[model samples]
Target: MTANDTDTDVLIAGGGLAGATLALALARMVPQLRVTVAETFPLASNAEPSSYQPSYDARSTALAWGSKMIYDQLGLWPALAQHAAPIHHIHVSDRGHFGAARLHAAEYRQDALGYVVDNRWMGLCLVRELLKTQVQWLAPAEVTDMTCHGDNVRVTVTTAGETRELSARCLVVADGGRSDLRERLGFQVRHQPYGQNALIANVTTADSHQFSAYERFTDSGPMALLPHGSPTRASHQSALVWTLSDSELKEVLAMPDADKCTRLQKRFGWRLGRFTRIGECNHYPLALTLVDNPVRPGVALVGNAAHSLHPVAGQGFNLALRGLMTLVEQFRLAGEQGSNPGELAVLQRYQQLHRSDRVQTAGFSDSLIQIFGSPLAPLTAARNAGLMGLDLLPAAKRWFAGNAMGLGGRKARIQRPGFDNSKALNHD
Candidate 1:
């Protein structure tokens, strides 16, 4: 069908975590709205290679407390919690330094600081929840072209062997860092490479993790070890994110399995005991990318398409989730007023509402990378002192904990208590 013939209220590009979650959110929040999600990857199957499933990759994600609340609103926590490992405490320290800080969930009166879940499990949960909704899913499809009009967006998508044009009142771009649609729309982005590569692997430790996450800073870069594995399992396993310079990354990637584990134990210290077994290792370049304008007349960008941050604080997805919730609220308001969801004013309002949070979160993540990654002795001392100070000051600790938990700044509609998700968009 031609763009003019096909009817859809919203067309979302990329059915990864962000796109799929947004689709499911709209389906629950605005049942009357027709939402369509186009994904380049096919529905995951046992035969599909791990590399083909971007959303269901082997990586693990740290979901903040606020993100957990969002999932609770979507009725997904019950399922996701089954596979998640709760992080009761976060231990931050500078390797080879005396400064260290510990953040506890009890200090903030919360059950968990965050939860770590395998990306594959999270994706499967999202897809499962999505299947239960009315949102249209077009997998193994790609958007080849897009044209924005005064009132709607025309999208040309290729699925199977046929190309079809579809029209939607709003086009939501959640295609991730290398978003083709974002480029097609000509959105300018400010990209900064950190000149570092992050090596990730699932590692087993001799001692039990005790549900704690660790962020250690070394001369090379920062390293994070997040608790992982099933609750009933006896062995201690954690997802490791080790940042290293290009040369160091190459050296580590080439090391023998036993030698690699020994080197990791030496660098990471004996906090979790000796690094025993490690799963397959993967590495990716690190960069900070932010779109100049995330919203236009008929479009809005969410998730990595809008802002991709360093994983230092694990805030990228949490920030994007908040932005998506804000956008959904704006659309609900517009629908209730019989206004176009893709109107420039509506999109701009959404952008303005989220601008501060986005800026702060991105800045926070970037600052952590720069300040902790610096090798200068003076700056290193300053950071060490900062960590020590955070541990000593209650108010400062509370503020930092709240921000780290994704509860700072203006709360999203989904975060506000008493806001009914089922009745959020009952305009009809």
Candidate 2:
């Protein structure tokens, strides 16, 4: 399996955002490497995948500034820009508290703190980009089992009702938070539940969002709203994510849309004025699921399969993007040294490079929850003071802003994707 005896240089399982993005990166950054993706969902085979038309109910994701830079280097940002809404400012506050923190992109000399994009649109865009790449794809396929042997990992993939075995120098598990492939591959996991669930939806307000994001901390839980644009309509809409207890979630789900909006409005305040109209509500349980050493000799896990984080801080996908690029950089190094991507040393180097980022990103989100989760009078006072302090302390604000934009600690200087013979390090 080690001696140039693999089907591809890299075989990625799961063609979701993580898998697709990783494939695109490898195809662009390391063009000499062979990459294939196995996905359970069927993809549009046409030269042009379906494009996005404005809709009120589509779910969304918040992409940090650093993520945007990475996507720009991949030449996908301009396409995404057409559908994305930039977050020029962020307002963080404690409900009913005197202290609040505001982050203005102009103050930081950045164009945007982050962006909000529709999930379906982004997925289709990724699919379109993948279609233009040399990376191979296996659709309606699943890596049912994986067995690592020698220098390569062999996967049993079921594609179009046919069972086949494929060997790859490196295997990436990007199946998501609940990955059967990861379990089958024996990746040990640590899970922690937050006793809360996130209720996500799109809502219209009385006033324009003006390219702002809001994060509100309440005794019940945390809530966030990011400006969401409608291409076909004029209603001022923002994506809503409300964390609630299990009982609260059930109650809200049973309530009428108007009542649910009332509940959200009560918690989030009159920042954007009234919640005029509410869209479909989708909910997710909050938890932290981290896999121990998500990489092995010939295999590795990326995205939610490796670490599932709380969404309040919007760090999950951004962190995954960082990790994904880090892996590609390691593979670049391996290629230069004439080493296999699946070799233990190569994958381990990737892990080491990404470990600090993973820890700090997780810590940032966890600290927010822990600091604000407690509603005791003393802690509430301290939390308010901390918020005010964060606003006043330039150094602290810069650090927080950098992390929020996915640019904190140990930088990665990305190169334009292609074969790079240049010796400029991607990280600073």
- Give the candidate number with the greatest lDDT: 2
Q: TM-score: which candidate is best?
A: 2
Q: What is the C-alpha lDDT profile of model 1 across 1-428, one tens digit per residue?
A: 33344478889999988998898889888777889999999987642223333322268889998888888888889878877888888999999998898998876566788998877777888887787788888989998777876588788899998999888888898999888878888999999999998888888889989999999988888899988876444348888988888998899889988988998988899999888888799988999999868998888999999999888688999888888888888988898988888889999998998888888888888988999888899998999899999999977777778777886554422222444534442211
Give TM-scores for every candidate, taking all chains together and pairing residue i with residue i. 0.91, 0.94
**Global lDDT of each model?**
0.83, 0.86
Which residue pairs in candidate 2 collide?
413-426
lDDT of 2 by residue, 159-198 (tens): 8889999988888999999999988888899999999999
RMSD of each candidate? 4.5, 3.9
Worst 10 residues of 1 by lDDT: 47-56
Q: Which residue pairs clash within candidate 1?
A: none
List candidate 2 segments past 4 Å from native: 2-4, 45-50, 230-235, 412-428
Error of 1 at 188 (Å): 0.2
Question: What stretches of model 1 exceed 4 Å from their correct place?
Answer: 1-6, 45-57, 232-235, 411-428
